[model samples]
Target: MGQQKTKKIEKEEPIKEEVKKPAEKIEEKKPEVKPAAKPKKAKAPRVRGQKWTAAKEKIGQKDYVIEEAIELAKSTNNAKFDASVEVHINFQLAKKSKEPIRGMVKLPHGTGKKLNVAIADDKLIEEITKTKKTPFDVLLAKTEDLAKLTKIAKILGPKGLMPSEKSGTLTADPKKTLEELNKGKISYKTDQFGILHQILGKISWDDKKLVENYQTMLSV
Candidate 1:
């Protein structure tokens, strides 16, 4: 009986040790299982065209000539349509020199539409009237006479003929102004943000016409 009891006790002790060893191993392995790392976020792609808001913000209170402005428009792909050179001259008195600077130029290709001009002088009005079958739609003696002129501000303003000081159209030189009108000279003002917008010429215009118009604008 004593020999049997000793053998049984030894077996029981071995079984207990085996169970304890497995439990210890399970506890030790728990801390080694870490959480997986998260993936990084992707960045957005840049837009191809320039932002109008951004351009306006950058041009504030700065005086940019028609030539510089045209170059910028071409390079940035902002303003390219008809032969129109729009510029934003600085608001400073010094920047507004007494000498007349050319404000806008139009190509022979036309702006793809007829221009409606209101002449401040009766002589110019009669001269424009003789071209009754010409491409122009309207010709008047007073600026305030045409309601349509005021109505088409968006179309004409960007085309640089809103009669504002910025456009140089509100002038006393009837002959010179009429000549420019016939030649497709328009003007536009920079908004509060100082960004001036205008067309140069149609894509169909020849290199010579483009160069001539470009030179004319630069001289202004």
Candidate 2:
């Protein structure tokens, strides 16, 4: 009886050892965790219109004044069609301005491009909504019609076609404004980037005409 009990105890010890071996093997086979990879930064899109690269480089880095810039700009216009001359002025306004400087001026010479004008009314509002595109370059509105056109503000605002009180496009009296606009008049305002850009004249015009037009814009 003693010898049988001894044999049974020895067999139970080996069985227990066999059961623990699998658990030890599972722990040894566990996978090692690695740190996550970082995301790559996005690159800015390249600017379009490579045709003006050489022309712009030729203008050089020198700070040319109004007169010298006009001549240089005229000389550099190598487009097949006549390029329009523009007067762009940088203002010292802060990024978050309480009272932004905005003004309208009547240039002696008109913008070379013919602009389609429209008076804002119920009929015109219906006409504009009927089409996907708004056909007019300038929109004139009175006090009564101004609130009515708010529905279409999203459409016209981005195109810079939305008439505002500050720009004098939205007015109680549009007749005088129309006459002034017909006589080479335009509005100039400092943009969000603090730059005022206005169409001065065409490159085909005489340098004298450009200078005079630029001076008129400067006066405004």
Candidate 3:
């Protein structure tokens, strides 16, 4: 027996199994949505009081003469205390003359209001600076005393009590001005819009008196 050729049995190597990874899933992005806006509410109508409604009814759509207007004003008045009868006059000025219309009016029957008039003097100035109180409504000054008033202009100017020649508050004779102011002398001037507002009288006055005042104001 020839020595069996030692055929070494060659061992076959085992094959390695490859692990497959699952394909990654792609996520689709969705757009974000917004909430809808709410609708706005409607506003309520203005409500008028019973007295105001009644008064409006009396003042119907019609142009009233001075006499009729005065009667209506008094009738429509509903104030607990006496109310003033006021007149608002609108002026159509020439385009060339836009200068403010100003002057004084002397009503035949004095305005029901009382005016406290004072003549500026050394004593009055001393009293005002010391007390810081303005006791008078209308101030009148003689020409000589006007220079002295500069000291207190800060106080009187704001109050419209400062004396000036244009307003006829500054004069050579204060006695005459006081006399005029005493006899229903009310000063008036147009606003920038050329409208004049004045108190004719109280609602309690008779129709004749109110009408007279209205006519007089119209004349101006």
Candidate 4:
């Protein structure tokens, strides 16, 4: 009986060893966890005018022309303006149109700079003083006087403020002219190709203001 018991105990030991081996193998095969991935940083967009290619792209994409361009200018958000500004317009008039379709508007917003106005007639000056109770920045007695006109030409010519007979702003009718002036009617001249050009105002205005001015120019 003792010998039979010894053999049975030896067989049971082998079964226990087999179970321990499987547990150790399971622990060795277990995988280690890795860290999570981080997000990448985004790049900033390029600024306008920084590159020649960007400038060309901007100009090419712009669609505003003539009065619409003026309106866009008025709508700009810039708060300050230079003493003088130059504006250009391209207009296509009907071939047979008898009346002049191009003119300038001074705008109630002013030119974003001080202006020296020269009036030809004494009566107009008197009326401006009497009714408006104000004197113009500068005045010229002879509208056609080349010498007097030449003196101020250097100052006003490049600035686009010099009065010309072609613009129709220099007229005998002070009351009518002043009425328009108060209502934002100024003057404008045309290029060699009959395209109207004038300084509307500063570039600091908002988009809506520019659009209004542009529409007014178109209507005129």
lDDT string, candidate 1, 145-206, tens digits: 34434544454445434454435555545457767766665553344543444445644444
TM-score between candidate 2 and the true structure: 0.70
lDDT of 3 by residue, 1-220 (tens): 6877677898999988999999999998888777877877888899999999999998989999988898898788889998899999989776667787877888877779898899998999999988879998889999888889998999998887888877788999999989998988888878778889888988899888888888889888
In terms of TM-score, the best-performing candidate is 3
Prediction RMSDs, each to the true structure: 19.8, 9.4, 13.2, 25.4
Q: TM-scores, in order shown? A: 0.32, 0.70, 0.72, 0.42
lDDT of 2 by residue, 53-74 (tens): 8777888788977788888887
* Model 2 whole-model lDDT (C-alpha atoms): 0.79
RMSD of 3: 13.2
lDDT of 4 by residue, 1-220 (tens): 4555434444445444444445444456668677877877788897554455543554465666655655443344233534233455567666665455545565655454455455544455445435643345433333444444454455555554455556654455545665556556666556556677655555655545555565566666
Question: Candidate 1 or 2, higher lDDT?
Answer: 2
Instruction: Give me the runs in candidate 4 sitting further than 4 Å from their true place.
Output: 1-53, 61-87, 93-110, 121-166, 173-183
The reply for model 3, stretches above 4 Å from the true place, is: 1-47, 93-99
- Arrange candidates by TM-score, descending: 3, 2, 4, 1
TM-score of 4: 0.42
The lDDT values for all models are 0.48, 0.79, 0.87, 0.52
Q: What is the lDDT of residue 180 in candidate 3?
A: 92
Clashing pairs in 2: none
